[model samples]
Target: MLVVEQLRKSFPTAQGPLPVLQGVDLCLARGSSLALMGESGSGKSTLLHLLAGLDCADSGSILIDGEPLDGRSESALARWRREGIGLVFQHYNLISSLNVAANLAFQARLAGRHDPQWLDYLTQQLGLMPLLQRYPEQLSGGQQQRVAIGRALAARPALLLADEPTGSLDEASSDEVLALMLQLVGEAGSSVLLVTHSPRLAARLQRRCVLHAGRVQAGPV
Candidate 1:
């Protein structure tokens, strides 16, 4: 569902341009799950952002489904993201003013494809039914992360991009959340590209790729 070729990205630094990714190539099949493993400065998150079209790459090409991701304007990318991609971040990016239910339905409603049944199912699956009326501040870190995952899946996106999805949760909570996420993604028939640091977590995925020195290397466990 996603293909990236020779992807390269660099950022302006006080000293010079800081290169983050170089000649990174990856392919994710439809309805498959892949884990990206890397250390702190290895550009895993940057790669996710590039795949999601949240940031532009300095060079190379990205294709989602069959559409090219390069050369699109910011607005065009935003439109594509709304229609095709769902993102889950390390930090739960929930709106403080909105309750869990509203936050979950926000994107789906905006896309003019709100499915109440699906939303309800997601809430129950994420163990978020009781917290629907509560705001982000009222929930614990794990609860908030569940809500974020719910919100991302609520859109019924074709591609799910998750960056350190369990970074803020305890061990039990992380395992629960990750299991739910994998199950839901399969049920929804969506492809996943998850970035994580845990070998145990990475081992659960169908395929694994390690990012180092701005390149991707894939192999068996």
Candidate 2:
């Protein structure tokens, strides 16, 4: 469902243009999960941003189900971000003002793809039914992360982009959250591109690749 080809990106520095992603290429099939593993400063997050259209690649192509995500206008990129992908971050970027119910449905509502039944199912499966009325500030880190995952999947997006999504939680919490995410993602038939540092966590995904010197290298999971 996702294809990236010769993806290159560089950042401007006072000295020169520092290259981040140099001819990176990878692919993830429909309903499959891929773990992106790399050391610090290997550009995993940068790759994710480029794929999400939050940042542009200097040269390359990113295709989701044959739809190109490169060189689009800001508005078009915004629409793509809303309609095509779901993002989960380690910070749990929840709307503090909205309660759990609103936060859980926020992305779906934004994408104009809200499915009440699906939202309800996610809520129940994530064990969030009891916290529906509570605010983010009132919940634990695990609870907040669950809400974030629900919000991401609420739209049934074609791809889910997660960047160290369980980094802030304990091992038990992380395992629970990831298990739930994989379960729901499978049910939704969405592809996954997860950026993680833990080999144990990466091992749980369908495949794993390491980023080295700004390129993808197939390796042991």
lDDT tens digits, residues 1-221, model 1?
Answer: 89999999999999999999989999999999999998899999889888878889999999877789999898888887887888899898999999999999987876676899999999999989888899999999989988888888887888999999999888888888899999998887889999999888888899999999999998574
Off by over 4 Å in 2: none
The runs of at least 3 residues in candidate 1 whose Cα sits more than 4 Å from the true structure, single-residue gaps closed, are none
Evaluate residue 85 in candidate 2 and report its C-alpha lDDT on the 0 to 100 scale.
93
In angstroms, how far off is 127's CA in candidate 2? 0.7
For model 2 the local lDDT of residue 185 reads 97
Clashing residue pairs in all predictions, respectively, total: 0, 0
Best TM-score among the predictions, by candidate number: 2
Per-residue lDDT of 75-105 in model 2, one digit per residue for the tens?
A: 9999889988999999999999999999999
Residue 167 displacement in candidate 1 (angstroms): 0.7
Error of 1 at 116 (Å): 0.5
